[model samples]
Target: MKQQIPLYLGIDGGGTKCKARLEDAQGNLLGEGLAGPANPVRGLALSQQAVLDSTLMALEQAKLGQGQLPSVNACLGLAGVNVALYANQYKNWRHPFAKLHVMSDLQAACLGAHGNQDGAVIICGTGFNAGAYINGQLTEVGGHGFELGDHASGARLGINAVRRVLEAIDGLCQHSSMTKAITSYTKCSNASALFETYHKATPSQFAALAPIVIQYAKQGDVHAVEIMRTCAAYIDLVVERLQKLCPPRFSMIGGIAEPMFQWLNKASQDALVDPLHSPEEGAILFARNNEH
Candidate 1:
């Protein structure tokens, strides 16, 4: 009887989207797929669906049928799995793969950025977080979710922009560039529309406003300048905390990384480095290293 070929799956499950890659035993690349957000906090059903959707797409690209799922070992690095309760809840969740290991998205990003070497990554997409892998030790900061934390994140910036707009309406703050920009973006000509738009907005929807803020700031808008200043300060705080565990060598990842990079001070900018591999590739490395 011939032995079956082994397959591995690596997933980067972020707050905004889930990405997956498939590889054979010898570390050769196979296929890749993408799906919606897989943050467990977003809801177990949605997360599971995203994981399945992305993994199935990957398998399809590899010319493998659904039956092959039972032969594949997988590592899922997901956002919102950092919370102990969510981790515990999702750890026992059903999946199609033969083996599955769940960890934080930041962990996957860090591993991907450094290729499992000692280094760190600051992720600033719809959410913010820093992960460090040093001396075989792992540490993470931020990623407290949209409600309590995620300072310097796209979502946070968007939220701040809206707040300033409201303040301006109330005659509390000057109607600076961001206020005009957000109001235009939201199409909220009146106070009621402004309230209605934000009240119904999602994190991704809010994050969409961040680029507008960036646009205005580049044109030297007063409010836009202050927003970036505050944003940089938050990112600086996160880096300072991570520095205690690892060196300043950092690769900034995610949708907002580039804009944030430009706003960061020269010292912080100096610390930024290029990633050796992508998060999905890092997930593959994680799968390769852990074979129980």
Candidate 2:
């Protein structure tokens, strides 16, 4: 009887979505899957379900069955795992994979962006975080979660936009096209309606409004531009701090990274390089390098 070749799974699980990639032992791509939000900080049960859902989808796409799960090795780069409590809780999950390795999404992104070489990465997505790997040491900054930090993140931008819109509606501030755009997007004609719409909004739900802010900023709306400038300033600070680590390369990623680039200072703009791979691929490299 011949032995079966090993299968590997790489997962990049973030506040907005979870992505999975399946590869053969020789590093050939097999299948991929995407699922909903998987940040444990938001909800541990939801995160776990997302991971499993994406993995099963990948398995099906790879023409494999659930029975093959025990033959697969998986590495998960997950958002919110930087918190010790969430990290330990995820590490103890009764997962279906043959072996599981877990790490923060920022670490996996840096590895992927720099091809597992020494580098730094700033993720400006639904949440914000920066990480650098240099000389076998990993340095991380920000990512304190939505309630506490996540400066320059989409959630922050969205919340700021909403605040501006509300102030404009209430006659507390001058209204602009940006505020009008936000009210239109939210279908809210008054402060009371807007408040009802977002009083219990999740980070991802807030992030959904960010594109409107970016669009208005691009159109030269005063309030939108001011918001974007603030966002850029925070990102600039993050870059300055990470550059002190002196990584050979640096990359900015996530949904807002490109749009926010124009608003960044020249120094921060010049410091960035294009990423070589996706975070999911970074998870694969991590799994391979750490496989026992």
Candidate 3:
């Protein structure tokens, strides 16, 4: 009689963190791990390191050594994998496990939400992006990046709120509590300091200020509240665009998903569906289904 070889591993690489799951061939999830962002767009070395770190963590947790891991296949659904900026890194990843497959972070989100079924996903977290699955094709709706896009993401929230505060200080906009909140969050003493801080600081750190905006918005601060409202509008725009493009079933993902949900238009909210699983689970599902 022939013996069955083992297969396992699923990874969800995000902007905030990476999640790795170790499952048996029979589909029993055995171990899991968490680590920093694996978005290749963030940096090649950073992204690869994130994935490697998180995957190793999971294996260690699962009590599976490298020899055991090598027997298991892996599928990495990584954020920013679709972007061409990190193309060089995408071609090469350090993984002892075989049967490796690379896909965009949003691809796993869509699959996780619908179990490889046709669907769309609206993700709002540190960054905002939307993707669709139609007839096995990956079609992205938003996700233009943090500069002028990512309008509905946490990074966008921080950038927009701070900019509003800066504008208000110049008397171009009305005074707002957000001005103080922004200053406090970044630990900038004054306007000049804030400008200097921006040039020296990373966008990821500024994006971390999103929680402050969320807090103020909940407290009814007008500018802060506007940030949330505006965020919803941008996400809704993507949903509407995806609807026109594919009109498939859509689900939500990410940390700020609930906030986006709360502020979405009633019609948009009505169209939402519950996610069947997360990107991590979807990556596992991929590994399980595709036997090496």
Candidate 4:
């Protein structure tokens, strides 16, 4: 009798986007996919659809059919999975796969960064989140969502940048390079107009401005520097807390990580490490070890 080929699926689901990767037993990459936001905290229905859509895209790229899903061991690392309410609700939630593992995106990043070894990861992306893996325990901080927390996240940085620009216009704070950059980016005549236009902007839209802030900071813009510094401080706090729980091997992950890391203190920089693999690989690692 011939042995069947083994396959695995790994998913990194976040507030901004969902990513999926398919690989054979030997860990050679087969295919990958991307979809919309998959943060369950925002809406479980949307999250479920995003996950399914991205996974199917990967399977299609791998020239596999839906029937193959039941045979493929899968792991999903999702944002908002750290919330007890969401985690509890989704733990027993139905999925298409025969075997599946679910964890927070931060946890997946940690596993990916350290390759299942003891370490920590701070995700400073569209949303902020941190996690540490020590021995067998996984602990997380932040990532409560924009309205609640996510202090060091891209969304937050953008929001702060906008606020500073508005203050600058009102003569409440120093007007610097960010004022012009933010005004141009928002395409608003003035700070008040920007505020009005962005009163209901989406997370992705707000996060879009973070790069502008970082750019100005790179040019020695006073307001931009302060904003970046503030973000760095928030990240530093999370790293400090995680280090207290786990080894100091920290990897900064996500869109804003590099810019933010540049502002961290020397001690924090000393503890920094590079990730061994992507979060998708971490999901594969989880699937390999946890498949039923």
Candidate 5:
């Protein structure tokens, strides 16, 4: 009999965007795909569509076609895996791939960070979330959606920083560089108009404001510095708690985490770990569906 060709796929689905990669059994990446936000909490339909879109896009990018795809194993690192509602809903998703493995985005980050060893990973992009993997088991904290939590996340930074700017403008807080910088970004004639964006903007849009905060902080803006500091502290608290929960080295992913690492105290920063691999690669590493 002629030998069958082997193929595999890895997916990193997040609140911001989804990334997919096609690889061979020996782990050589062949092609890639990019998709939309896959947060189940936002809405099941949206999450499912985004994921499916990305997956199909990936297949198209690889040019493997369906017959070759069915033999491919897929690992999906999603944003809202902890919510049983999401998981249950995901159970119904049908794909052409031979097998599919799903996990929280943090789990994939852990796999990317420690490669299946014991460790903790914090995701700090639009919203915050943390995960611990010990002995192949996964534990998670935060990521409870925007209103309930997600401290130290990009969304929180922007929301908080903007609020501070409003406060300063209204004499609620002392004047600072943050107010001037934020006011420039808002371009609002008056504070009352600021509500326009706040009322209509999405969480990711708010998060995009984080860079303004960071910029003001570098210029010695007290409010901006405080915002960044508070974010760092929240991240520290979560990681410290995870340490008690898992007792392993700590690592981080997402935009917030990469910057927060710089703001952490030297000792805490010393223990930081750069991701050993990307979440896309991590998906392929643990996927059992890959052909040998």
Candidate 6:
């Protein structure tokens, strides 16, 4: 029988979604797939299922079947794995791939952004995190999770907007168009209603309100402007911290990266460059380098 060609899979799993890229040993792209959230911090079972679902989708797109899974090497860059507990949990999963390597999504983004060269990346989506690669060492900052940190994140923006709306409804603060808009969006005209609606909301649910805040800020609403400015200031500080590493390249990525760019300080703005590749591609690089 002819020897089957080696296959590689790169998985980028985050709070919102999981993406997979399939490639042959020669670096030729074969297929790609996307699925729902795979952040193990939220739920290890859900994350594992998402990983398998996305990988299967990629395999199907490549004209392969489940049997081929045993021939594939995979590198998974996942959110929440930065924590030792979550990392250990994921490493212990009985996955089907021939080989599996797990790493933090921030590290994967940095690798992808610089095409494996030394660089840095800041991710600003439902959550926030920053990582830098310098002189073969990988250093990370922030990403403590929603409750403790995640400064300048979409979830933070949403939470602040809701708080402001509640304050306005209670007459503690003057209402602006932004506040009114938020109340309307939540369908909560009174403070009690607002509290009930979001009291048990998840990070993604809160993050859903981020666009409303950005829109109202663009329209010059005082509350919105203040919220955006505060978030921007936090990002500025993160940039300053990362700058100490002096990475050869720096990039900001995630759902809010572009929308929030104008609000950032000039120094933070000047530090960014376009990423050379997507995080999934970076995962592929990792799989290739680490394959035994």
Best candidate according to TM-score: 2
* Tens digits of per-residue lDDT for model 5, 1-292: 2214556777887777888888776776667888777788777788777766776776676665555667778888888777788888888887666788887787777887777667888888888888788876777888887778888888898889778877877888887777777778878646678877786676777888888887777777888888889888877777677867744677788877766777776655765677788887777777843433
How well is each residue in 1-292 modelled by candidate 1, as lDDT tens digits?
2215678899998777899999999888888999998888878888889999999999888888788988888998888888998899887887778888888888888888887888888888888878788877778877799888888788888888888788889898789867886888889966788889887676787898998888888888887888888989888877777767756358889888987788887767877798888887888788878877
lDDT per residue, candidate 2, 142-223, as tens digits? Answer: 8899989998999999999999998897789899998998888899999899889998899999899999999999999999
- Using TM-score as the yardstick, the better of models 1 and 2 is 2
To one decimal, what is the Cα RMSD in angstroms of model 4 from the true structure? 2.4
The root-mean-square deviation over C-alpha atoms between each candidate and the true structure, in angstroms, is: 2.4, 1.6, 2.8, 2.4, 2.9, 1.9
**lDDT score, residue 131, model 5?**
76
Candidate order by TM-score, highest to lowest? Answer: 2, 6, 4, 1, 3, 5
Off by over 4 Å in 5: 1-5, 65-69, 245-248, 289-292
Per-prediction count of colliding residue pairs? 0, 0, 0, 0, 0, 0
Deviation in angstroms for 215 in model 2? 0.7
Give the alpha carbon lDDT tens digit for every residue of 1-292 in model 3.
2213575778888777888887776777677889887877778788778877887787787776656656768888887767766644677766566778787878878878888788888887777678887886778867766775788887888878778877887888886677787877678756687788775554476678888888888888899988889988887777787877654678888877876688889778877888999888887777666764
Ranking by lDDT: 2, 6, 4, 1, 3, 5
Candidate 3 lDDT? 0.77
lDDT by residue (268-287, candidate 4, tens digit) is 78778888888888989989
User: Which residue runs of candidate 1 sit more than 4 Å off their true CA positions?
Assistant: 1-4
Clashing pairs in 6: none
TM-score of each: 0.92, 0.97, 0.91, 0.92, 0.89, 0.95
| Deviation of model 2 at 264, angstroms | 0.6
Query: In angstroms, how far off is 90's CA in candidate 6?
Result: 0.8
Off by over 4 Å in 2: 1-4
Show pairs that collide, candidate 4: none
